[model samples]
Target: MKYMSICIISFFNLIFFSISLFIMSLYFIMNEYVIFLEWEVVSLNSLSIVMTFLFDWMSLMFMSFVLLISSLVIYYSKEYMSGDLNINRFIMLVLMFVLSMMLLIISPNLISILLGWDGLGLISYCLVIYFNNVKSYNAGMLTALMNRIGDVALLLAIAWMLNYGSWNYYYYLDYMKNDNNMMLIGGLVMLAAMTKSAQIPFSSWLPAAMAAPTPVSALVHSSTLVTAGIYLLIRFNLLLVNTWMSQLLLLISGLTMFMSGLGANFEFDLKKIIALSTLSQLGLMMMILSMGYYKLAFFHLLTHALFKALLFMCAGMIIHNMNNFQDLRLMGGLSIYMPLTSSCFNIANLALCGMPFLAGFYSKDLILEIASLSVLNMFIYYLFYFSTGLTVCYSFRLVYYSMTGELNCSSLNVLNNEGWIMLKGMLGLMFMSIIGGSMLSWLIFLTPPMICLPSLMKFMTLLVCVIGGLIGYFISKISLFFINKSLNNYMTSLFVGSMWFMPYISTYGLINYSLKIGMNTFKNFDQGWIEFIGSQNLYNKLVNFSKFNNVVMNNNLKIYLLIFILWIMILMMFLMFL
Candidate 1:
């Protein structure tokens, strides 16, 4: 009860602060006022250690949404972890997680960014393992290891930036583009962001991290952990314009978007499906970001946070009532029983599908429209639209299985939307999911994004979305005959559905070869010839020589004395001759 009250009180405080920050951000955005404050922590020779805080409209705005979602996640967790003994610990970890994100957002210094960056990774690992089970442990390990790749990349970027004398990459980002030696920093930064965002081979950890408690999922997936990378990219997006690597980033982000969308369609687990959608949205942000539309990406990022948080909260409510069962195959007709949850879930889901007048439409539609207007190849253009379609496909698939389908539950199970606290949490995001898009759209863009495109190209997004929805609905109702027929292409579905074996590639695919080589190294070197020739062989020879000397000295003292006398005589004779 004490812990519960703490979270409840904290939630109210955070929400108040979040609202204040949002208002401040609007003022900052309108006036174009950037408040940069720096404190000199220390100075060594010419190098001054300064901690910098950047309160621009972008950072302020992004941090506002982050705090808003975090506040609700805290409020939601009160009931989510109500029965747990360590709700206090969970609250601490969640707050720590939010603080780390705040640090990352406000700092322009690479060193400070990394401090916050590493804090995020560390706190996330703690949260992932909060359930303290083998699944959580494994998931946490994967999450930590995967994020460590980004941490190392960011560390390397910091080291490379040392040549520039200060770790403030923001100050030097423009200068970095011209110097070949310095341009490497952009690639390093890009690599770091990609790893953090869980692109391609790094993608497996995002889904597996669903082993975390649902409230953690709501926070991590929506606004904090995954978005951290996208936010960083938004900060450095200008580098993508002049660098040759931007094309590669575009391709990678597109593939990540498409891959995650496909994976979500095939996923059965409720949380994992939402997790995949988060990944898909991340990829979308990165895609536009690589194209140098940082503001659009940021816009999408903020909007995505609102709806995705609501989506996860709704999914949590469902899972909570379903006795922790997350398989959508077993969840059906949830709308009939839990009307409020179903309504929120469907609205968030539709927003995810980029439905008109919703938060997603304002950003997502603009991104695709702008991308369509760009002078890009047909392949890249198709990648953007096709990935959008897949987003709708998987979203409607979820609706079919969870909302409108037959209720597949065990006897004696009772499902209702009874938790007022959790419901309140979802309601805040639900209202935002409806209006957050236009709200952010108005604030972020002084002028609307204009794209003079053919009508077919303009309407293409809606057309694809509709067709994709129909396909997704029918796909969810797969007939037994089709299931039998798909046995032939089971391998294909397995490949695509399993994120193209990305989970395997990320987990077993990554670990097996490394572990195999390590074992071989141990067998052939550390435990084998090196052990014999290095320490063991040296020890054996030293012991044998010591024993030989001991036998002569102890067993034959006369011989020892005679040798000493002979050595002295020889030394005396040699000295006399000299």
Candidate 2:
């Protein structure tokens, strides 16, 4: 019964998705764009607080896609989490996430955006800790606190924006585009976006967030939470273009793509591999956006959502059949047992590799073509294409390990294609993965991206694809005996395999040092100096003063008798003098 209700909600959302998409398309074609719906809520002497919703092709199309993916995830979860005792609560949280994302999509006001931003963080934490285990709790805390840093950054941006006298950032993005203060605002927004999108120092929480149910992983990593940052930057791209911050962003995002790709290659957890891939794609989006290709970045963002969500769902199915085992080393010969799921996985993986005519192809290829044509230095240029190759390299490695290799598990696996409900959910995305890029390219862009490059430059993607495939294939098959026997194996393997020590730096390095400082402060200040000077010393002084007063009072009777005798003698002397 709870399942049916969730399905009904999903079906309802699908209708809304279709209608919203249609309206967005019509609005785009008519070119009568940008509807602002506002209602005054409060008024001060000269200030007004109003509720505002911005409707345009960007927001509408994005919201529609979010709803579509969310609905599918809801449907998918029905099967994936059917055995959970708290499925109803889980569905409610998912619904809340959808609502929060929608609020974020429509709001042009910074204050309103906070509602959504914070909702995403809080709800994501709840989702991450839903399993009520130690790992879940730790991962949830890490995810929440890491995101909270971004939340704080955004609040700072909002405070800085008060210099403009309003929270409506849409109005100020253009007006304050060139102001230095605006640069600060943009910087803060970028910091916020970076944390949310898992760039650099903030990237660890993303893979850790995989502790959540795979449905949440699908929705959060793919379209909702991670994309929130990219989407924010896309909205603010006008202010960011040509700024030093944007250049800095380009550098950081490029490195992120490279690092995440390298990390994915070294990762063994199946879901973590996919999560790292999502991180790499996010970096790609941010990199392009930093280069001022806002439309292309947004286009890729939408296309990525389709294939990535499907990829996570595919991973979920495999994990489910494996009885919660998510290690790629233990997952082999899965294709023989679960052909349909494997096919879906392969298709998603290919799309992720940016194969021609697939969803990732249209946007990714255009971005590459644009990157190649840009007036960039050799470092950025090489990083861009090399990361592209790394993407395919890790992808093929993942494919070979899980699908084409020997059955490496310790026990016999009976993988079945019986999750009809989950399969149904995947089918929708599969169709989208095949056609979403082309469809989005047509609707989002007025003209196809013009590419004029040498044949070698044009074929660079294909060349890398081939090279990566061969390398991945051979590397997967090769024995690591020589490397294992080397003295440096532990150090080298630890660095690469542990995401370059990010988990350690984020958790132990940062947390331990902070705790150490806190303990020192507690022992020396709160328990030592403050106790001596403020509490213990003051109490001792009061006790000593009371004891002195008591002794003086006890001697009062003797003092009074002596005073009476002295007064009588003084009166007699005065009479004799008179």
Candidate 3:
């Protein structure tokens, strides 16, 4: 316990250091001169790959928030993980994750960025499987493999960068504007980002990763792992701004947001609901980014990190008190028993739903307003708003089931108010969640975006929230059987409840298709054609030659005499020619 307390204090020191550095970096931000620290690793005749670190307002500001949240999480985990024997290991893993994120934040060189990127994937896998349970193992494998796809894509992008003679992308983004190689690099980079960020096709891993401890979830889902992709895209936005791939990213990101939002409404597990919410928010970040609003996307990333981390920590408290049960059906009236944790949870949820003046409003509401103003296709228009409404829909439903309904846990279960460390963590973030958006908005946006839209478009967010609230209320209040009996509702429920079958498609569908293709190739090409022409055909020819030799030898003296006479005649002819 003493060691844990000391560890928490050390993290506070990191927070202080980051804050001071951010203030110092502000001057450089104004001058727009990026600070670069470099050391030569190797210099071959014409090609040199050097270690490089980039410092700018964006990296510093984002790093500051990441440090603050990570410090709070470390403090919170002291109480949350106190019962575990390997608490020190957990804390160290969390620290390693923070370090990896910092490295990623400061790297301008694709080569250096890979170190950080791979560190994130490797450390996250360790943290995810920390529990040593079957569920944790499976989740970790899924998480690692999914992230590995991104890692490979990033490596390919780095290979493409060799054409530019430098791995430092900051120097080449503008120069390589219309180059085809750059286009391929941009596409690969987006694919990498999509995987790390859990966008669409790679979305299943984020939710499955909830098998890790809650504190890890709070950190990974909220800030570190998922945000890594958004950070990369923020850096690469200049190159991707006008590409068709950006448009495709816009489509996929919109679908991801809508799909996750719908899935959250049907999810019963409390942690999973929160995980899906993270996915939804990630989609929001990616969608805004695809539109080239990198700064705004980054703004949301920071604010979302605050509230989502707080939300997960609050859920940790609930799960702790409930004997580790995560089902919303087994939880209710927790507010009566643990008022502080409940309040924090509600605040985080409200913030997530974009309650005015909360952390999410500054970013999420602005994102919606911007989307509405953009001259997008009708499908994207509807998706943007519908996803926004679904956020409220699931949030309200979760609140009703977990916080306000009749007591659902076992009579023996006693909700304790003993999470001093946990509450301390939540208090800091709760305060931030309430004010982070407004504070960041002032700091980052010199002048808020000016949108002159019709009154209907302006108030669309409010109207959707209200309608979503009412629908969410009715759905939660009504009996499950009544809702399930209807055939249409049943179908819709199955579709939405299963995340539109994304998990099955990504996990089973991809594996099945890949295996099928591999098997067909092996059978038709490697086994059939290659075997017939190379190995099998060569073996048959060798066997026929051996049989002919054996038959000639078996013809005894006659064959030998004929061969000798022919050889003698050939020898005499060669001598005469010589």
Candidate 4:
């Protein structure tokens, strides 16, 4: 059985590798060709729409990230879910989702993009409910509902484009370059992006999505599905540049970043904490997208995929070994029992916390630099800087609380090795998370290489991360001081004590008012004059009304019959005269 699983996993990896190579080769070829050829539409049909595939540097970079993370996830899932009853079904869904996402990445038209967009949503919902538990089912449904809202926006935008303007991609592209209505389309697209990316109000579904299997959470939420919205915005950057929609995106993105970070602090479930972190990081990516630096956003997405997946997988390993306990309070000093897992977790956390020389530092620092240099409002730049502090706080808290505290589990079942297959997958990602940024710099068409950060700024960012981590460590220690007296009192007052009672109060008030109105109306209707007429002996009243109605209808029928006969006579005389 183990050998069979290994063979199956290896086959999938081979297939993905071949496809990735094909995509990269095509990207290079088309990128050169697009510069010389006139933009042309190839086909337009109900089933599919294919355009002259243009490969800019940004698209190439995104495609590469998608391919890399997707391949790693598939490899990891085989071991992680090996003994599951529906492993084959799970793998099939993962493959289908990956194919659809790849199609979305390269899709040229709005319709093709939506096809891929909804495909990701569908597969993700399936994966979230893979466990067949009620919680998983409910979470999947919530995610589907939220994503459907975004899907509707995209659908409406497509309809508007087709009916009001042109249905073809090239036509729309031409129109966007010169049309005044670009703002309307841009706004609609931004709404669609916000929902898919899980920004602000739409973000509530993502945290609940932690009910999914950790691999699903790691792959879909951390890497691909959540990034699709940012991909859409970047794909249509030219249309969104220098618009009010861009400013709105920046504002919402900043708010989401801060709010999700704060929410992570309150969460005790390990997966949910990571889920919130994904949301926060995605918000930051959206903010970077708003700055019109698609490359930087893509860079952040790629680096995040490596580290975040590692974190989730490590969390999964820890939970799986512990019989699926997810609370951080139950996990303490895992570093001694699971050294490799703990080490991998810390490395990924270091990357996530933006430690110097790690992959996250390179990408995150680029975003901060871009934000600082942005021609937009200065407040946004400062907001981005402030959010970094929160990012560090939550990220380090996850690491410290899980790995640094005293070992609390009794009679630990210490496995000599966590499964080699799973370890291999983690090691692959850990390698990438360490050096993926420099490699990405070489792959893309950017100046001075991405690794070449200004020394002073790099030092300051590193200092911020260290300071944030230390502060977070101390705060977690003193958290118990507030946990018992003040924390409980505060939560009780804020939620359970005051505003929590409002629903019952409101319901009672509504019922009471409704009864009062009903009683008054009933009293008015029961007034003696109308009641006296209605209360006349029922049998006699019915008989009299029936007789009156019958007499009136009979008289009317006779009169109509006479008039018809007279009209017929007149017509006959007139015909004879003629």
Write candidate 1's Cα lDDT for 169-218 as tens digits.
Answer: 77887766677656788888888898889998789999888988889999
Per-residue CA lDDT of candidate 2, range 185-260, in tens?
9999999999999999799999999999999999998899999999999989997788899899999999889989
Clashing pairs in 1: none
Tens digits of per-residue lDDT for model 4, 1-578: 75347536654674476457546655664455332123445545654333434455455556656666666666777777877867777777877887788778766678778888999999989988988899889789888978998899888878777654444454465456446555566677889889888887677678778888887887877668888888888767777666677778889899788777766665677998888789889989988888677777877887898899889888888887766788787777788778888888888988887777788878887677666555657577656766687778877777777888775554564533467777777887788888976766555433654344477754666676677777777767777577536774575456432223332333344478889888877776665445656764565689899999898787997878999999999999999999
TM-score (all chains, Cα) for each model: 0.89, 0.88, 0.87, 0.79
lDDT of 3: 0.88
lDDT score at residue 549, model 3, on the 0-100 scale: 91
lDDT of each: 0.88, 0.89, 0.88, 0.74
**Could you give the candidate ranking by lDDT, starting with the highest?**
2, 3, 1, 4
Find the 10 residues in a row with the least total lDDT in model 4.
496-505
Q: Could you tell me the TM-score of candidate 4?
A: 0.79
Candidate 4 displacement at residue 363 in angstroms: 0.8
Q: Candidate 2: lDDT over CA atoms?
A: 0.89
* Candidate that would win on TM-score: 1
